[model samples]
Target: MSNLQAKIKTDSWINATWSEYIQITENSDYQKAKFYYNKGKFRIEMSPLGNDHASDHNIITYAINLYAVVKGINLNGKDNCTYRKTGYQDAQPDLSYYIEDTVDAVPYGTSIISLDEFSPPTLVVEIANSSLADDKGEKKNLYEDLQVKEYWIIDVNKLEIIAFAIENEGSHRIRESQVLPKLEIALLEEAIRKTRQTNHSKVGLWLLEQFQK
Candidate 1:
């Protein structure tokens, strides 16, 4: 590609090949952009993550970890992890988890997890302050086709969580987690609401009390 013909920052990804998608994601301009490539198209998520988004991301992460510990469940979680299926599909979930019986799903020190080699995460989460639409539609299809057990989108603006259960290459809305039994979605949402009024330390303490009950 020549100087004038160079791929612009806002270039369309619809007709771009998988190699082109990878090249664009590697560009310095999109260092913070989350990437999702499925079928023949790619979507660059350049939404500026706001303070609320980051707060919910952190709280949910901590809450899940605390819940697992309190319940004696085996699980591992990742933030901003990339899972790629080579030329076919790729997803960079904001947070992902390998639940009990699959805590060691991916080996240590591996970068850019290749879905062709390893199993998909048991749970995937997208903190959706601004990207809720794509997170619910296109990204949902990506995770479903990737065969993740559960997918969640935390709507920061609405203080709501939209969970889904994936099976047979399809998904359906869910109210509670199928992988982490006894974990109430409502309680997590409640904790998210409390974060607006208090710090994570206090929110976390309250969560601990709730989980133990």
Candidate 2:
């Protein structure tokens, strides 16, 4: 984080400007933090920074990276962008993946794309430590509307994973082990434990092995 980046991070939300939003959007360092405040062209609402517990955030991020590497999927970990669904909404899933095939299908330099525009991920993961209600409510509705193939919510306090999948045109139904059947629930539990004791890479490697299997 450079001095400028540090300043931007510390700056209050009231001082934010469109130029600052644009600059942060273009820069890689501030992607997650940037999306924390603005949605750019997207109209979706995001929970405030303090809404999510830090520990839960770290665990979810690790799990996503691990799953991506294991599956050879191009997971854009926390790169927030506006997607044009029925309406535009900005979302920063704790982890979101655009498989290699999906990326190859998109035209280069295209920013806003629709759910129909590309292949949906095998799964999308969110950690609900502080934003449990929002994750289960508004965010869930948003993902359903966008027609994401699968969604996972990690409840930090309960130490459980809630997974959902699109069942119909506008409906999403919750399921266990539906998205990544190969991934053992035990492994996710272990990953969450390791994330508390060490870096997320341990969980990442564990998930990579599952994908390799």
Candidate 3:
């Protein structure tokens, strides 16, 4: 990290000019940090992820993938893909997916996808471990503004999945997923619990049964 980047605050909102935010994102010093910009405020999440966060992230990814495959839903997922709307907004969601009709919307050889040129992800996820508050607050608004159809936050400590269905720039808590259709939130919560005592493969087997139902 350069002295300049070292001076920038991490994991908090900073009043930054649009140009500053863009420059910081392009800097190699903050490559690992998740970046967000909205209403002239910029945030860089530089916290080191722990085991619990990573575990939830992987399990959720696996669950989503398996559900899509079994149910034959057209899905293209991106882990930490950045999307920006020039001077207005930007976000690098922890997990992003283009579902059903938009599965192949983003073409090949694209880097740092521009929201102006392509449709935004239909679903966005944030594995909220230490950043649960921000995930539900500022990040929620961000996803809403991005117009994603659905947003999910996986709470690591509670082993809960909080899902929201976004519409008309507002979000409402939902127990079931609208985008994936018939994918129950409760089943995902159960799968996370089972992983504590069972191997991932066994947990995966259980998940398969759930998805098939």
Best lDDT among the predictions, by candidate number: 3
Clashes of each: 0, 2, 0
Q: List, residue by residue over 1-213, the lDDT tens digit for candidate 2.
A: 245455552223323444554455577554445243222321222336453356666666666566766666564533344444322334556666554445454455866545456554445667676566767766777677566767777888777777777656354455445554455565676667666666656666665665576
Query: What's the true lDDT of residue 21 in model 1?
Result: 80
Superior by TM-score: candidate 2 or candidate 3: 3
Clashes of 2: 2
TM-score ranking of the models: 3, 1, 2
lDDT of 1 at 107: 92
The TM-score obtained by model 1 is: 0.94
lDDT of each: 0.88, 0.56, 0.90
Pick out the ten consecutive residues of candidate 2 with the lowest summed lDDT.
36-45
lDDT of 1 at 180: 87
List, residue by residue over 117-139, the lDDT tens digit for candidate 3: 99999999999988899999998
Error of 3 at 112 (Å): 0.9
Query: Per-residue lDDT of 1-213 in model 1, one digit per residue for the tens?
Result: 234126444313354678878887887878988888899888777867879998999999999999999999899999999999999998999999999877897999999999999999999999997678888888899999999999999999999999999999999888889988988899999999999999999999999999999
TM-score of each: 0.94, 0.59, 0.95
